[model samples]
Target: MLAFRIVILAAFAVAAIAFPRAAIAAEESCPGLVARRGLPIVPASLAADAVQLTYIGHSTFLFETPSGVRIATDYNDFVRPRTTPDVVTMNRAHSTHYSDNPEPGIKRILRGWDPAGGPARHDVQFGDVRIRNVVTNIRQWGGETTLRDGNSIFVFEAADLCIAHLGHLHHTLTPEHLKQLGRIDVLLVPVDGSYTLDLDGMMEVIASINPRIAIPMHFFGLSTLDRFLARAEGQGFTVERRPTPTLTLSRTSLPPTPRVLALPGR
Candidate 1:
């Protein structure tokens, strides 16, 4: 009992010491920015830019281009009036990832289909953006015995920036997965640390990808975000909590080194 108590106490001490340093490390990576909380309201001029994105609750996101090309990701439930999108992508995770078709005028729909035989790779082009999806392993129905090819990691290339989304990932990324991912400028990752990989595992993958911007998603509650930020503190990534759920981003406006942008998913 004494030995066990000592081990537990030691673990807590390590975590407490590690968190502050991690936070400081995140601050040092970026020279000009400061860490601030709460959402920022986006201006109309920025909203009208060429590449604009808005978080629409949970995994649902609305991305629009100046040419009116709108794309939605994992959008199938509790979405707002702005739910209309030119294209929608649904991964094979759960019912939340898919739903009945849109009202009308919705142009394209993409699903991450992984069959026993194999999965199909999609090279999608919309306006000036290009996207590709690669399949990986994710447990189905939360069972260890029953394994299926359902989840996928999608890569989007726009404005000379490559962004990857780890969809319902259940396992650590292999070296082959790294090779398949090539170079990513921004990464939209899940940090729930329960349904998705834990904080440490998420760090491993982020380290491997080494993207310029890391946007965390699929996490609930404020403390989940805090813990994720804590885990990434000393990893040399600046953490910015944007003031709003929306952001106007382009290749030119992106930072040179890695950073974390916490977007509001509601």
Candidate 2:
């Protein structure tokens, strides 16, 4: 009888060893536990409240963080901004959006797609800024082939603001994509009707994102830009064309209603 009891006890110990109760509890209640300990929930905002965004033409925009961190999107040699960037992001759809020979001085270079035809993963923090990405599929060979996880939506978080740049997006976002994006305060979107998603599909994306401000990019001519502006205006978005290509933004400075701002660019 004592041997039988010892065998049952040994079985129970093995089960407990395989599935740790403490680990399960931690996994289920980590957030609550941190809150109870008074730990910081999110990263603190930068000392300076405003972040500057500069249009560098054709899907390339330079983001200047308050702490002097500069990030350029779609960084290729042809349309790259004059000043060197601290960090640069690229997409793989075309050579126009990426460069094989990036300047050696750049601190970080992030690519949206893996050269091996896999998904690219990036989550980096530098100074006052944090950058992350969400993967999406793209069309290749003139829509003859669909490459899985071929593009990325880069998100920059700084000064308590979330800025997202849709890089060579070829389709409407899925619910999983929205969950990954969270809340975007500023959105940089492509306005080219045929190359990226159609005008109607792009409008649907804007509505789903619901950013406080939307900036147009990737439009080759005024006609494409005008069509996007008109559609946004029809949806009750305030369309404003800025004389300059740069804008400084902060949480407090956001418009009461969502606005589409057009910056002059090549």
TM per candidate comes to: 0.76, 0.82
Off by over 4 Å in 1: 1-50, 115-117
Candidate maximizing TM-score: 2
RMSD of 1: 12.6
lDDT (tens digit, per residue) of candidate 1 on 67-164: 55667877575564365677877776677766665547678777766454567477777665566786777666766653455777877655455667
Specify the highest-lDDT model's number: 2
Q: Count clashing pairs, candidate 1.
A: 6
Question: What tens digits encode model 2's per-residue C-alpha lDDT throughout 1-266?
Answer: 00010000101111111111121212222111111122232332323766778888999998877667789999997898778999999998898899999998899999999888678998877666778899998899565699999999998887667888999999998776876777777899998988888998898888877777899999988998999999888777778888778777777777655778898874
Off by over 4 Å in 2: 1-47
